[model samples]
Target: MNRPSILWKLYIAAFYVFLFAPLLVVAIFAFNASPFPSPPWKGFTLEWFIGNGSVFGKPGVLMDPIWLTTIGNSFKIALPVALLAVIIGTVNAWVLERAEFRGKTLLAMMMLWPLVIPGVVLGISILAFFSRTANGLEDVLNTDIDSLRPGLPLVILGQLSFILTIATLIIAARLRKFDRSLEEAALDLGASRTRVLRTVTLPFLQPALIGAGLVALLMSFENFNTTLMLVGSDPPLPITMYGQMREGATPAINAVSLMLMLGVGGIASIFALTSKAQQ
Candidate 1:
């Protein structure tokens, strides 16, 4: 057995520092009483965390109506995207992995093509495609395009376009390791195709399904470039944050960042524990 060299230990320590130092700074500054997020080390305060104005004689950073609404809107888009993307992705994974058909290669390539496209390009293309389609509908139906505004619905679709591919890949990788003999035996004995899928395949794929959905949820929540193009009037948290930052950053943004980190960290911790227990 050999110990790592002193240089290697220093290198690993430096890598972790580079990775987490910024996050640590952001977390620490969330409690800063200063108006701005940067240093000169203002005294610590809980004003940003609790939103308890009575205690501080002023409202916290999280009290803005638009910020609260943006948070809600993010959840709205992310939830549906996670569900729909997972469903479509699971079916696509199953079909691609278990079935035989013409154009299969083409379909698989199409599934992965979204990953190669830049988000900005994808957003612009989707906006153009939908705008043209909406125009055509307006001409045909002789109605206003108000109902067809690229709002949350369009945001969901845009996110789903790429997120579904992520789901498919995650599930597909898990599917590759699955033992088909259980499925074959179930089919041969008494189970129908749907039954086999429901009872055997889906159960076996549960971990992948959950992991993929969580990933989709996180991606949708944090999405900016594509959501910015298609979000219309209802901005998600990322879009709102970007707009705020362009003006100037405040401790409020740091507080928001801290909250997000805590929320995601909590979820990830739970997921890790659950997976470990299952194992």
Candidate 2:
């Protein structure tokens, strides 16, 4: 391999710095002994990890119920959304890729609409539509629909609307490269469609399926705007952090950010190592 040109080397260095500099700063501050987040690092301390009932006037350290609940809520939403997106998206991809139908291009374009729509707009639209539907249902049934409130379920629905499209696109792209003859051969050999799919197609699609689900989960977890508009009372971690930041910036917030960064980074590292080992 040829050595990188000076310009390319400079660009790579700049890109890495840009990507990691803020994270490095945040991690540094998470351990800084100074009360203020900005610093002149007084010294290193772990009190930021565990402090009095609050961090710089924001609820508390990571131990706060709100923070814990927010994290739980995020996972609750993300997990279901990932599962549902994979199911729906996989079906959609299969149909589009296997079935020869009219208006296929149009259908493909329509599938991409969610990706193109702004998150805030999508959230508001979903909230308005669900609100009206829920009110109508309540009027008809004379019962309340508590599950529709700003919580895990609503957040999942909001995220799935867009994230599912992404999953579909990924799976569909993979489907385009698949050999259909294998399924036909399996069916000719007495295997049912379900059996063929379960034994053959699914295994082939596993990598794409996993990738898409991970993408959907990450998108759902990090989502804020749609979650903000659709979520009623309880806020997810990002929203909770936003509220804390607005109220007052604190080292605890920084600490929480650092923890989150490390958690995600660690998961990514483990995945990479495992994947390499498998290879």
Candidate 3:
């Protein structure tokens, strides 16, 4: 068993090739000089990433104001979603892991609902519920309820609804493995509950919290189905990319994808290093 059978070796090789070949192609095509990313590759250029948008020049992802604005909107939405989701997740993890209450098993099962629901269905439900609630409130109360209308706020809420579930699961998994004796020891020495939590509990949760926040941020950034239902006048980067792809395929999309892959990969690497150091 020291060596894999020929069939197993072939399967393993195919698996890796299948996994990475498309990404490698995308990286290569990002620099393709052709306006489109199809076959018959032209020389090479960075215009898709940094062009000046002259009469003959392509307005790269960086040069396009619309793309930049959409990118900004994505960050605007993702940051808040990540932070708030993490906070909610931490609270959920604490309650679910440390405290017990009536219907705990049912509540725990309910927390997994989001993980199984289809994203588009979830988006539509949230949109419809909020829209009707807003209408009802405006009609009865005779006041504007702008926040309940479709917009970034609603997008954040929709994303948060599902993302917090993921975050909660992650944090709770970590909290489950935590040694309670540390907190008990600190408390036995007359440490306040808040102090013990702040000093001991939170420190132990650093890795899980960081992982959850990163997942939330990335998920929010690339989210499409839910975002599509809830987007307002402003669109996020993924929505903008969809619009562009609908118009025509271009090397610019590849360039943007390559950049995202590099950026996210770098952030993940750093996070891994930091977590290792903390350990």
Predicted model with the maximum lDDT = 3
Q: On a 0 to 100 scale, what is the lDDT of residue 47 in model 2?
A: 70
Write model 2 residue lDDT over 1-279, tens digit each, in one string: 498899999999999999999989988998877677888988887777776644444344655676778788778788899899999999999888988889988998898899889999999898888888889999999987977655667778898889989999888888887888998999999999899999989987877777777777778778988998988676777898899888876677788898888777765665466444433
* Model 2: CA > 4 A from native: 1-15, 50-60, 266-279
The C-alpha lDDT values of all candidates are 0.86, 0.81, 0.88
> CA shift at 272, candidate 2, in angstroms?
6.4
Q: In candidate 2, what residue range of length 10 has the lowest lDDT sum?
A: 270-279
Compute the lDDT of residue 229 as modeled in candidate 3.
93
Residue 163 in candidate 3, Cα distance off native in Å: 0.8
Per-residue lDDT over 1-279 for candidate 1, one digit per residue giving the tens place of the 0 to 100 score: 388999999999999999999999989998988767778986988777666566544456578666688899999999999999889998899888988999999999999999999999998899889888889999999876753567998899999989999999988888988999999999999999999989998998888888888888889998888888898888999998998889887677788888899888876776677456435
Go through the candidates in order and give the C-alpha RMSD of each one to the true structure.
2.5, 3.2, 1.9
- Per residue, candidate 3 scores C-alpha lDDT tens digits across 67-89 of 78888899999999999988999
What pairs collide in candidate 3?
none
Residue pairs with colliding backbones in model 1 are none
For every model shown, the clashing-pair count is 0, 1, 0
List the candidate numbers ranked by lDDT, top first: 3, 1, 2
Give residue 277's error in model 1 in angstroms: 7.2
